[model samples]
Target: MIEANTPLLRLLRTYWPLVMLSLGLLIIVAIVDSSGDVILAQTLIEGLVRIVIVAALYLFIGNSGIISFGHIGFVMIGAYATAWQTCCPYTREMFMPGLPVYLLNNSHHFVLAIFLGGLLAAVVALISGYAIMRLSGIAASIGTFALMMVFYSIYLRWSTWTSGASSVIGLPTTTTPWVGYAYAVVAIVGAFLYSRSKWGLALRSSRDDEVAAKAAGVNVFGQRLLAFVVSAFFCGMAGGLFGHFLGMLTVDSFGLGMTFITLSMLVLGGMQSLTGAVVGVVVLSFLIDILRRLENGMVSGLNLPTSSAEVFVGIVIILILMFRQSGITGNQEVYWPFKGDVSASSAMKRQS
Candidate 1:
């Protein structure tokens, strides 16, 4: 018989929630790959990419009870950063002549470039968040929105570097379903670890009541800034994956349209819970895929406009907000259902 007090059993009891989520994702990926359908597989990869983005958003917004409209700006920063290191050297020399000689002359591996993209975005977040995180409530949200707009305008006008409203092509198409899946898993684990960390708990305390958190000796601003930087890192990596997946980058692709859609997914999924983020992405992605097919006339005798999916998604969001404000997961994490002593399960968790 298995020993109940053994380390292995304790580990399992502590992390059963993560194990279950990971297995569920793996099963979905396996089924899709087994079908041998290229279009569906491609869509699956895209959905996984969104999971990374939405999960990163949840790391900050969910824990801090803050909304951000400019996180997509970090995504744009990361995409072009990857483009700089992974795009063709010849294209760089011709179109992005303003790039430093080192970058213009050499191209790096996509994996290295992707990581560098995230690092650069994190650096930007560190700088901007220092100021933005000082503001609370809606002011901070507006600050992020402004940051995104500033990024959009700069990228739009920076012709010699970002192609100036033109598409930056020749990025190696290296993002396969497996690659996307790996990154998505990494994102989930990273978010979970952070959520359980002391910093995460402190930030959430401040989120719920800033005054009380301050009375308890928490560095509210510091916690917010830390979460912001970490969240940006994952978002930037997602942007790199997005660029490679499509083999092209455009400023317009990272604008308001993307910002709103991602925010909508986060809110729909229950911005206060990580499980909600993943579930929201999966459900909405599936819905969009079906709606897209209908829009493309997949069904005989059916007519739908090109933007029907967006309209339908908006309607769904309205209904969700009106009926279930806490989101589908009710702001709750997936827990070990068999555990009779829930406190013991929590106590068994080792601090990261």
Candidate 2:
């Protein structure tokens, strides 16, 4: 520990300039982001939502070294939970006319409903993680994707609860742009904190090589499960806000379409870097918005076909994967301090 700390302390002193630059950029992003018009502001908040979700992915995929194709299931569950709580049903005047006796129909409290939505997702993750984590490589990815598909099928058929494919309308528009941005910042900070914690190290070790890590007494299954479930919780929260923000949600938001879009954002930034995920969400989301605008706007000669945005993002992802296979950061991060690099080493050296 002492030996490592000396090198870490030296690195911190060595790279203070980089540290300052990063902090300055973050402050600027927060300030400028908050000052935009409501429409643009909302878009920015949505960007933050993606940032948080992608950051969580970085933790699991980046640290635990597992790719999840269907984690959107948690978000689907979350969107419905919040939508059900906040919307007025035909029976209850509060909900609509009246809610079922046991359904807990009030969604007025923003903090509570959103947290509950996230919690519900986490609970689902707890169960799902156990089953899915048992698999490895492409097998685990396929298994998780299957789970997402199964959930999607259920949601589409469960008209009594999810409103099926028609659409879930009347979700109260209480999720503000600010709240979304706040949560995004929290997610980024939290992910950074988690990935630098002791558990993160174990998770990363597992990702790098489960057999080797396990040989050192690491619990690979547990690590992957822990990382994945945490990521799922935030994804659910992001979805809940998404459902409410638009004042309605469709099953499609939590479908394969969203799964790919969000994953593409993460992939474009970098599969291995938390920084990459954050950047990926910010940059790709804006590009997507631009593509959406182009699709909506008539071209110089003719109107573009519908769904062009999806096509564009898909192409972008393909190019990124082809050209930049290491993923945004190759599992590297800017916070080398907490990453147990020089910072941790410095502490150990000081103690020594």
Candidate 3:
């Protein structure tokens, strides 16, 4: 039997598996970097960003039981926000001449830029989530998809601010594997803490039974909106990291393809648990990388078509959903010492 402990200690106990998994990935990244493979290093950086993004998704969707397609809209906003604050003066002047005098004239530090980017996205989420969270089920999902389309259309046309369909260039590229690793750790820890918090419990209660939760005095909409804003903050930071990683930003980069990819990662890993998000991203990322190698004839004599990776991923997703809709983790987290199933009653009591 487990002894009663402080919330912090219990939180750590419940999430130690996730923490160790992240540390293990960081070690792998270090090993890859040590091997002097710049290409692998870059790919790992990309995977790290996906881990952050998917973790953000889990923090909101997993706890709240809401599926949002518009989270990537926050990502777009964050990327351009970082670009506006960090891009060179000449680049801004040349591409975004109509920007405010303060933004147009000065470039900020990368850290500050990332913070502001995330802050901006969080602010937007706060405003938008008020209405969006009031919606439920497929309607809520559609509302979010509409929000994404609106953002996409505006970014595609607002040339002065977003450079229209063109890419925003000349931003600093300072994201190393270490930096990505740091953010991934932050994402993992932050998500785990939130999942075990009072608000998280209340949200999950509402998710499981809205009528009972309402009877118990839970404010479902408020909880959902709170999660939305917090999730957007991390997603925004992911976007900023992505911008700095690639040193470029385009509206299309955060469009439908990105939405589907991240959602797939979340669903494939198990949408109900944090471990699912991390495992899903790592597994699928490596799978895609391996398929890409095969496509390039790097693996034996097999030379698959350029689009084979996507096809394989789609097939795999279908198979997983058909056989195990809860994903690889089956809506359960990875616990320490032994991989045993955790019941909801125990989790709730521990949080209490």
Model 3: per-residue Cα lDDT over 19-123, one tens digit each: 777878878788988999876887889999888999999999999888999999998888899889998667688888779999998889988888899899999
Per-residue C-alpha lDDT of model 2 across residues 223-299, encoded as one tens digit per residue: 88888888888877887888777887778778788788888888887887767787787777777766666677645
Q: What value does the lDDT take at residue 158 in candidate 2?
A: 78
Off by over 4 Å in 2: 1-39, 89-100, 298-303, 328-331, 335-352
TM-score ranking, high to low = 1, 3, 2
- Tens-place lDDT digits, model 1, residues 1-352: 4433668777775676578777888998999999998878878988898899999999999998889998999999999999999887666777678899889888899889989999999999999999999999999999999999999999999989999888888888889888999999999999999998999999999999999999999999999999999999999999999999999899999988888788778878888988889888888888888888899999978868899999998998899889998888877777655544355336656432
For model 2, what is the error of residue 82's alpha carbon versus the real structure, in angstroms, after optimal superposition? 1.5
Worst lDDT 10-window in candidate 1: 336-345
Reference-based lDDT, each prediction: 0.89, 0.73, 0.88
Higher TM-score: candidate 2 or 3? 3
lDDT for model 1, on a 0 to 1 scale? 0.89
Colliding pairs, model 1:
none
Clashes of each: 0, 17, 0
RMSD per candidate (Å) reads 3.6, 5.7, 3.4
What TM-score against the true fold does each predicted structure earn?
0.94, 0.82, 0.92
At residue 248, candidate 1 shows an lDDT of: 89
